[model samples]
Target: MSVQIQAEEQRYSRQQIRDLATELLINVGVREQFPTPLEEIIHYLGYTIEEFEPDDDTDRVSGAVNHRQQIIYINHQDAPRRQMFTLAHEIGHVFLHREQEANHIDYRDGAMTPREQEANHFAAELLMPENHFRHTWMTWEGEPELVAATYGVSAEAVRVRADILKLT
Candidate 1:
């Protein structure tokens, strides 16, 4: 059976979310860079990654710190690219939402919530910085793969950014 997935209505600009992510990382002492050392930064925030079997009903999930525990769980039964996005998404919860109160984010089937959308934007901006992505793409003489590689993201991501930039 085929399923329908809805494209989320964006509530924040790429610039706004990027700025918030930058501020969060800076407050945590993560130096400005491509693919910021998220694991390390999260560690400093007193969170750890744990593994569990996939729910079959869900792609991956994350657990936030609750009570006095300092651990978060991420399901590894996913593609490398998806695993990367999931991890970034969890980091999104850590910075953008109430971690101490919320315990889990079952980011299954690209779920949508206002908060999840915010996190998605944060992840996209963090993975693909707008200014850097634009500058790098401008240098690209029309090579999508080249630009995607330079930014360590998927070609589709670069393609979307290009569309957003009105480059193609």
Candidate 2:
């Protein structure tokens, strides 16, 4: 019921992971750098999304994905934007950590490894792509919150993306 990195068998650079995620979006016909329907992309990749409740003590586990079954579950209590991030993060694991996922490793250790960090980058990129984010920023005239609303992502995600894209 959990998808995890197995013993860190494969180490992917954050950039590599981000490239893969962008490639996936392109493969799914995302030709524009705009707010993509993260749910539709997940479904297109054969993933089904559901909402669940997590205990207050479990902040590390916001969401979980089972790629073999093509299912993703997000915490119901999380902010909508947080759930979006979790979904995109899980999508990162689907491609970046295929082997460990194929072996059915449950990533419940709550440790932040290169893989997890890469996944976070992937999530940020997927939710807010570089070029599209830049354009959106220009449209909003430097208001991150406005960009966040249009993209259905968090304001923090927008700012982080802005920093990554050197727009800040």
Candidate 3:
């Protein structure tokens, strides 16, 4: 496909993933509930969540989902918020990209593949739906840290959510 076509396809894929995430959140009662029980949702979906240290020579792989094993492995070195977010991101891949063979996402601060971006969007929606996030952002005096603490997510996540909801 041409670059424009590829971009359009990716955009469509990401939107579908977002819709799925929203549905899952609502089905699990997390969309209306603060501090979404994301871990519980992951377990409810029958995926195993595990932690491990990355080998010294390789890059810091934040999370990986092996479809054959139905397992998610999160890096132990990351903060709690990142770990949880990584798990959500991996969950996104399994559910949203079911046709793909497999892919391990690197949680680095740089360019991301279209699939990686989709997973990130999935994670964000899973953790903080835009409507709920905006309500919380407005009611909580716009304190990202306070909202983050309430949601058990990183303040940066809240900031990004705020920006997404155009609160920033």
Best by lDDT: 3
**TM-score of model 1 relative to the true fold?**
0.71
| TM-score preference between candidates 2 and 3, better one | 3
Task: Report the C-alpha lDDT of model 3 over 4-73, residue by residue, as the tens digit.
Answer: 5654465435467668888898777677666778777777788788788878743558888887777888
Task: Report the Cα lDDT for candidate 2.
Answer: 0.75
Tens-digit lDDT track of model 1 for 1-168: 122122223256667788987777677675456555667766876778776676665444533333236566666666555555566667776666643234655556555778677776776666666677678777887588888666566677668667866878
After superposition on all CA atoms, what RMSD does each candidate show versus the true structure? 7.0, 4.5, 3.2
* Residues forming the 10-long window of minimal summed lDDT in candidate 3: 6-15
Which model is ahead, 2 or 3, in terms of lDDT?
Answer: 3
Per-model TM-score, in order, reads 0.71, 0.80, 0.84
Please write out the lDDT profile of model 2 over residues 1-168, one tens digit for every residue. Answer: 232433564677667766887888888887464566787788777778877667666544677777677777777778888777878888877767655655222244567877777777888878787777778899999898899997888898888788877888
How many clashes does each candidate structure show, in the order listed?
A: 0, 1, 0
* TM-score (C-alpha) between model 3 and the true structure: 0.84
- List of clashing residue pairs for candidate 3: none
